[model samples]
Target: MIELAQDSGIWTATINRPEKANALTDKMLTELAEIAEEAGQPGGARLLILTGAGKVFSAGADLDAMQGGLATSPVWERLSSAIAALPCLSIAALNGTVAGGAMGMALACDFRVAVAGADVFYPVMKRGFLPQPSDPARLAALIGPARSRLILLVGQRLDAATALDWGLYDRIAQPGALMDAVRDLAADVLAATPQHVAAIKRLIP
Candidate 1:
């Protein structure tokens, strides 16, 4: 499923199935909802930092799960929205390649940090389909329309440095230093007043 670890006020959620590139499962998504619920409560958790176990962050939803859903799957959207709406500030620490619906999870975070080896490619179009339909607005906000078009339409793979240059990642760290960097970032966030963080984040229209 997932690994939950805590430091002072920071909670780190690690996607643990490295064998499958930490692919998302319906059970995993449901577990995430429960984790979010726990973290949202009083005296529970504050800032949440998400990363993966071995190499890649996540390779997107489980193909078996997706097939099982058929035409009526709401699991993906539900879990993504839950992750997006958590009161705790969220940070994504990408370790490797990201693709397909997995980008949706990364996009939900308030801040994203990646290592040089990390990259992302969304190939829904090449597969003869479009994105989830609601992703355009968020994608535009993070990386702008032109880049988003390049990614979604052309299916270009963006290296970490290129992504940073294009404003995809707020910062980049060496692969080995990523977690340390993320910890420092979480500490900085935890040091701030929750009201200020909430206010400033909300004011970003």
Candidate 2:
């Protein structure tokens, strides 16, 4: 499930299924896409934050749903694309672990702020599956081809510090300070004119 709230110029969306490590279902992914669409509208929030409730950020697709053939890459792509297309700046606040397809969602965001001890990994290769074509390029763009290979091919689970060093995280926050750090970054972003911020977002690749 997804929880959305708006205050002033900021909108926050939290993945709420902590029992399953916040693994996304089809309906949840649909809700995320819908939220992204809403955030893109005129007079919408100037900043959007994506995060997870409880501990883990997301465990990617629900295994049961995948077993039922309900988890498809296209739907995931649609969700990621919707976030990427938003006119406002978007940030991924990684409260905990970020895994598998959820990595793509974070990569789609304009910035990522992570808890210092959170872990990140993609196990698609181990599962005998391939990610969407753009995912590798996005990873490479953030880090580099060598690190991307370590993640995508070697199945490396990167700690937050290493990921930050590799450029996957824009900032790292100490435990219990993740949201505060995110708010600090958001405040800095808010200091800029919304028009200019949106224009810069549009100008970025």
Candidate 3:
């Protein structure tokens, strides 16, 4: 399940299927993409935050759905690309570990802050499936090609400390402080006019 909440100029989207580690089904991915598309429109949010309801941000594609062709679905690319193209700032407030295709959305965000003790990895290699199209390039841009290779190709799992050190995560927060850290980052943008936020974000890329 996906839940979206908006306040002031910030929008927070929470992955709510924590019982399954927030594993994403095809429908959930499509809904996220549509929400992102909406956020990029005229008079939309100034900051968008992606997070999860429980400990894990996402376990990636749902296990049962993966066998039904969800793994190679074009929806992953659609969702991540939409997030990357958002006019406002996008942040992945990783509440916990991120794995498999879930890495795409977080990688597309402008910033990522993970909770302490969390891990990050995309084990597509061991899973016998190539990652979503834009994932490798986006990940390589943030953490470097060698490190990206270590995760995607070698299936290495990175703890939060290591992820921050390698630039995979911009900051690490205690679980209780995760949303506070995210809101702190969003404050200035939230105060600015939507146009100003979009213009400044456009200047970055």
**Model 2 stretches astray by more than 4 angstroms:** none
Per-residue lDDT of candidate 3, residues 36-114 (tens digit) = 9999998776888999988899999999999999999999999999999998989999999998999999999999988
Ranking by TM-score: 3, 2, 1
Residue-by-residue lDDT tens digits, candidate 2, 1-205: 7999999879999999999999988889889988998898988878999999988999988998877664554778888888888888899999999998888889999889998767999998897778865689889999999999999999999999999989999999977898788888878678887788888877778
Q: How close is candidate 3 to the true structure, as a TM-score?
A: 0.97
| Best candidate, TM-score | 3
Each prediction's TM-score versus the true structure: 0.89, 0.95, 0.97
Minimum summed lDDT over a 10-residue window in model 3 is located at 189-198
Evaluate model 1: give its lDDT: 0.77
Error of 2 at 183 (Å): 1.7
lDDT of 3 at 30: 98
Question: Residue 48's C-alpha lDDT in candidate 3?
Answer: 88
In order, the Cα lDDT scores of the candidates are: 0.77, 0.88, 0.91
lDDT leader? 3
